[model samples]
Target chain A: MANKLFDIIKSDLAELETALHESVVSPVATITEIGNHLIKAGGKRLRPAMFFLAARCSENFDLKRVMPLAVALELIHMASLVHDDVLDSAATRRGEATANAKWGNQLAILAGDYLFAKAFVLVTENGYGERVNNQLSRLLADLSAGELIQNKEIYKASCDTEEYYERIAMKTANFLAISCQLGAHVMGLPEKDVQALYDYGYSVGMAFQLTDDLLDLTGDSKTIGKPAGNDILQGIITLPAIRALETSPDKDELLSIVTNRDMTKEDLNRALEIVRATDGIDFTKNKVEEYLDRARNVLPESIPEDVRAAYMMAADFIAGREF
Target chain B: MANKLFDIIKSDLAELETALHESVVSPVATITEIGNHLIKAGGKRLRPAMFFLAARCSENFDLKRVMPLAVALELIHMASLVHDDVLDSAATRRGEATANAKWGNQLAILAGDYLFAKAFVLVTENGYGERVNNQLSRLLADLSAGELIQNKEIYKASCDTEEYYERIAMKTANFLAISCQLGAHVMGLPEKDVQALYDYGYSVGMAFQLTDDLLDLTGDSKTIGKPAGNDILQGIITLPAIRALETSPDKDELLSIVTNRDMTKEDLNRALEIVRATDGIDFTKNKVEEYLDRARNVLPESIPEDVRAAYMMAADFIAGREF
Candidate 1:
């Protein structure tokens, strides 16, 4: 499904790739190297894809005009990830050494700052309007605040579903939602249509994160690009774990494993068993389906059938994605 | 001289304080705490003062119109300093615990990012025009790039005076130049006057940094905030040290101490003595005077005499400042 959707906007993503490569080049060799390292690490480019898909809903979908904004979106995502790796002390991301691991924490911090500044340089160079600028600014604040909040919550067994939702909303959902809304907005869509795109992106984003957390527990290292149960090992209690805490028969043992920073492999295996024995996995899958349904249902009726179908396919692809 | 200049901008500076305090307050307790920690550390507020003084050159100056820009200038400066502390592993700044020291590098990184985003948010809220935005975007890139370059050169005894100048230009001078230009541009000043203000800011910025480097070698910890020879101890080869590398009779000894990251107290003391014996100290002082002269020379004749006097006083203050 993702491959089919990619085929629809394949050329635009290619242009974005070239633009992203060119954007990170700098006089400072270290910055350029780190930027290239991140670029080659390979992401799904979900935000840019969503941006292009939403723009396709409008008649005036000019790639030339919208390319900078799309690039800025991805760069912002990359910058946050670089900083996230530093905060997490993550050695590898997506099966590759992280910038911090490759070039120490100090250089990684500077490289992240460089990427962030470069994002703004691209946007301001294109003279993006106040709405885009304002949204980007707010988005940055939310990204960092969300990370800070998540950092503060690490190892807490009491981490609840509502808190989990708010964290994912700030960290992922709003970013995707804004990506779609901005794409629709710059293509001259009406307010109603823009809001619809936002809603669609939000639903998909929620589903996307739920799937990600699920894979952290269920997927193998080769497929997921990290060790199984990486988040739990890092003391990041996600939705599945939260649900398990509420419903697991062995709740006290699970809670102890979740709270202990030094849990053994046996502890991890047992915690995984406890979560799977309860309704936790099923509850999370249901939630993901519910969000994807909301996404598919929110596609504006005025959009051409082909574009609408593509959006639906995108949502479906997110639902079934393992990595 | 600094006290006299402060008296001139007293009320405006007071307003900027309130705005900066309010700007950093956030719903996240950690962010708010770190932000306030930075605010309480008490920087010189040199960037904002330069901005206000540049704006005062134009009759159209309105404090309300330019207040957000002023707040943003200071925020950018503060944000860079926060990140700088993390990069340097600095324990204290301005006689207070650095964010990294008190909260750890991870939170400090996030706090720095939060401050940076807040600065952009303030600017976008005011909708500053493309030129201002462009300069700011470039300013951020330069700031980070400067740090990266400087970080790369750490403990390299062969580092040259030219490289040192390039680093300071990117890290400090360009930021100051843009601050003055943005202030003048926002006040509807002519291109020539804007350029003049930029030059004035640039010259003073060079002198300011040169003086800072000197203080690190010559002034005691009580007056300079950090201990004397702190820069050398951190393996940061500044201008005076670069000069000593050129002209010191004990050049090999100095180079060995610099290259050896584990230099002892005797090595540091010997290195300091070598630097003081050469033209290193005097050469850097002469360079400071040269830049200050250029700064004073560039004050536009179109400005009122009293405003001109204030700008002169600001430059003079940079020349004589111990901290």
Candidate 2:
């Protein structure tokens, strides 16, 4: 299954790189310098993979027709991350210093705007519109709101799990679902299949994030390329941290650290131990694997064996990803 | 001519108001406060007006059907302005303290994102898709490039008029043109009519900015709701300032004042006087009025008299507004 998807990704891979590089900003004199800088920085290109894989499963699927949708989803994800870093005041992303920290918030904001414009332009030129275009665009709205809500709740040690689920669902999972759903719909897939992809992708995304959050607490900096406990440092209350704070005997003790700048490396290490010892990482990672299993179950048993492997690969990729 | 447009504006007022208010974002927990502040703080709501008016003139015009297109245009316009202020470090808009200044850059950036989300939601929810929705989304990409170009030219006191025209055409005029184009397309207008409205709105929006730039130098604070010559302080290189800087005997002196913050109130006043005396305002404003005339000429004489009147009124509103 992964092999077929990889072949598809290989052919148009250059197109994605080209569109992202050139369309990042108009040849405007001033903002382009900073815009180019961020666009050039590497990203994992994960969303596109999911898009290609999911679209190929549909009888209506056509890889040539769906490249722009794939690009659009990735671009929206990239644009949001750009803005999110500025909002988070993050110093680095994908292992490089961020646009905002390096160039100031003004350029970062404009650069993100530039990417968004490019994404839409790509979609329009490729003729993704009406129902599919509208649905994907609406998902962007939801994703953006989820980001804002997540930002608002960052470090609220007592933040509700339901809100946490809702926030992450919007910001991370829903777009993946939309990406999969869009690919299927664009190929003119049946409504049921499109919806199934959407459900599977959404749950998988949630699971991916839950595992990612757990890894932020347990994974090495080299493996993740992000500092361990960085989310907690930023006061972002992820699922694992939420669990540990709820069940731990030192719940009130952990509560003070919610806004406390005094949370040292020692504290982070200790919290990691507590979160791990309390089964927090296991709880979230288990939930993540559960979604991946469900996503696997959603695949049509009648799919060509090659296509089936690609879908299975997606499940494997999310499950095995260290970060 | 203005009276006719006003009559149309008056008679079909309720729906536009509902669309405008409906364009207001909902009470999402995080975005509720900041989002509403900008939405409720009324703009002239001109973007929506252009959209609705163009839809009304379409052969397949459905008055009730194109509301989302109208609302979406306004959201895109508003989002751009909110983000632009942060880029420009503008202190006030519509006589109120700006979103960035009031809420800090974080909230303003998030608020702009919220508006953008809402805009696309409106677009997709309106039952539009395919080329129309794709085309509308691409406008954002064009607009962002235009802004990047604008940022590049800022404080280049000797910037040429062509560059100025291109920037405003993209950043300001494109939204208006798209507003009309989408309006017509969504309402099932004849292809010829939709293109005509697009060109008409494009020309009118260019004219609108030309007059607006003139007003930046000459309009009173109470009338324009901004300090006369505020653009000079912000280092925005408007067309009038571009031309005047080229011709003034005190040209270097004027450029210095316009580009540098060291200029006193006296220097600011002198720069304004020089721009005025150089026929800069008249030059720009006359060019603006010419576009308005051209827009009027573009409306096919075969149009119903009422529709023609409304289109001309909309152009006049752009050309003649005090602000």
Candidate 3:
């Protein structure tokens, strides 16, 4: 079933590929250079795929309405990735050099700004321009504010779970929620259904990010397509770390290892082992499942069964990805 | 009349002080700590006042229709300031510390992004939402690209006049053009008039920047609110220097003086003398007048007498300003 559904997205994604290149890439300036570089690096077009697939799910969907929005979602995601690379001061993304690494920070920032402006253009060009755009601007604002907040909170060993969730929701989940809501909006769905789709996407995004935190711990560089444990090195405390700190008797013991830069290889191995022995990973996974359950519950009763075929697979893929 | 208009805008600006505070400033992470520090520090809100006043120029106009766009324009201006301070590596703006100076480059970049997002939100919420949005987005992309290009080219004393004009058009003129067009657009004007207003604004904006280039050479810091000869210090070959380089030997002489070190009082005096002795200031002033002439020619024929009052005043203000 997974392979069959993946086959469907591959074909639809091919069509989206043409539009993405044609509409988003411009010869205007070095922006197109940086834009094409980051965009073409081949990250999974997951958000756009959901938007396109979700349109198929709606009984009365408008593909034209959804596709531009789908394009905008991907642009927003790409823009954030550009910014993330800058803030993280990273060199590579998806095994390719980041925009910042290639063009320097100012150019990287301008590239991000270009992509973000392109997003605003694409969404406004689509119908439902007002609602999607205002919300998306607010959404971008929240995302950046969250990043700033995270930067402020970095290396602080005592972040509360609520603050943790707020950070994740703003930085990660909001875009997904916005992506799905925009999809439904473009389909001209009833307001109530739009709200439900937003809820579903929000919960599923939280679940996806929960899994992402787990992936960071357990996944390898080749599998993740980037360096392993980079987030840990950068002092990003994920859900697993928060949970581990909350539940472990050796909380201080683990944090002392995680927080201190003086730790040796043996110390890293011991800390990784201690974190594994704790309930953090399992706890995070269960939390993902809880959100997934909420997402499943909010899905509309009349969603087209054939269209659900693709969405279900996509959701599963998001939840179960190795990277 | 300028004082009366300034008084009017100052009084009305207080009403929007809160909206700007919430919509534009507060969402920035260092809203109170950093953003407000820059915004409230002595810089004039001229662009925003232009928007509000232009929006109120006619019986058909609703100040509300144009106010958000005004705020957006101001935000874009602010964003560029944040970035420009970085590019120029200047430590002061409007006689106070710059965003980069106070918060570092990373924070400056993020703060700029915050303002950009807020600006888009302001425009996205109102009139011809999509069309205006597309125009604004394109303008922003052009502006950022222009800045990047300027950073690269301003170092080259041999850059042609045409290249310099194009850069200034994108970096400085386009937004003011869009702002006027957006102002007319929110008033529900016909398409031709909107385009007319835009072209008029574009030429005027070009004149405006040329005036600024001249002022940077001849104006006082108290009036211009920054150190004089700073542009020469930064290696930016403005129209005066270009004209001087092309038509006289002074530009070559001035170009030789700009160095990696901050200009001393001695260097500034010598450079200023060379610029004047070479007629660089007069050459730029002549170019500014030509642009002003072209700008006045493009104003739409259908505007009400009183409405044209502010527009004409704006053009004069741009053309006549010391900087």
- Candidate that would win on TM-score: 1
lDDT of 2 by residue, A1-323 (tens): 22444674555555667665665444564456665666577665667776776777766666668877776777787778889888878898877888888877776787788777667667767766566666666777787777767666656674588988987788788878887787777777778877887887887788778877778888888999887888888778888878878898877766777657568887777766676777677788788878888888886554557656766777787788876
Q: What is the lDDT, from 0 to 100, of the residue A164 in candidate 1? A: 88
Q: What TM-score does each of the candidates earn?
A: 0.97, 0.90, 0.89
DockQ of each: 0.78, 0.53, 0.53
Give lDDT tens digits, candidate 3, residues B23-79: 644633474466677567635565565555545544686656566777677778888
* Candidate no. 2 TM-score: 0.90
Write model 3 residue lDDT over A1-323, tens digit each, in one string.
22567664565677666777766556455766676677678777878776766666666765555667777778888888887788788889888999888888777777787778787777766656677778888888777777776766665654488877887898878877877777777777778877887888888888888888788887877788655455566667887777777778888887887687566667666666777788888888889888888887888777777655566665677667787
What are the fnat scores of the candidates, in the order listed? 0.70, 0.62, 0.56
Restricted to chain B, the TM-score per model reads 0.97, 0.91, 0.88
lDDT of 3: 0.73
Lowest lDDT 10-mer window, candidate 1 chain B? B1-10
Model 1 lDDT per residue over B1-323, tens place? 23755676777888988888889888888988888888888888889988988898887879999999999889889989999988888888878999999988878898888888888888988978766777787899899999999887789865667878989999888888888899899998889999999999999999988998899999987898766898889889988888898878889899999888999988899999999998888899999999999999998889867678888988878887877
**Candidate 2 — which residues are off by over 4 angstroms?**
A1-15, A22-26, A29-39, A58-61, A101-103, A261-277, B1-5, B23-27, B58-61, B89-91, B101-103, B261-267, B314-319
Note the residue pairs that clash in candidate 3. B212-B323
Docking class of 2: medium
Report model 3's chain A TM-score: 0.92
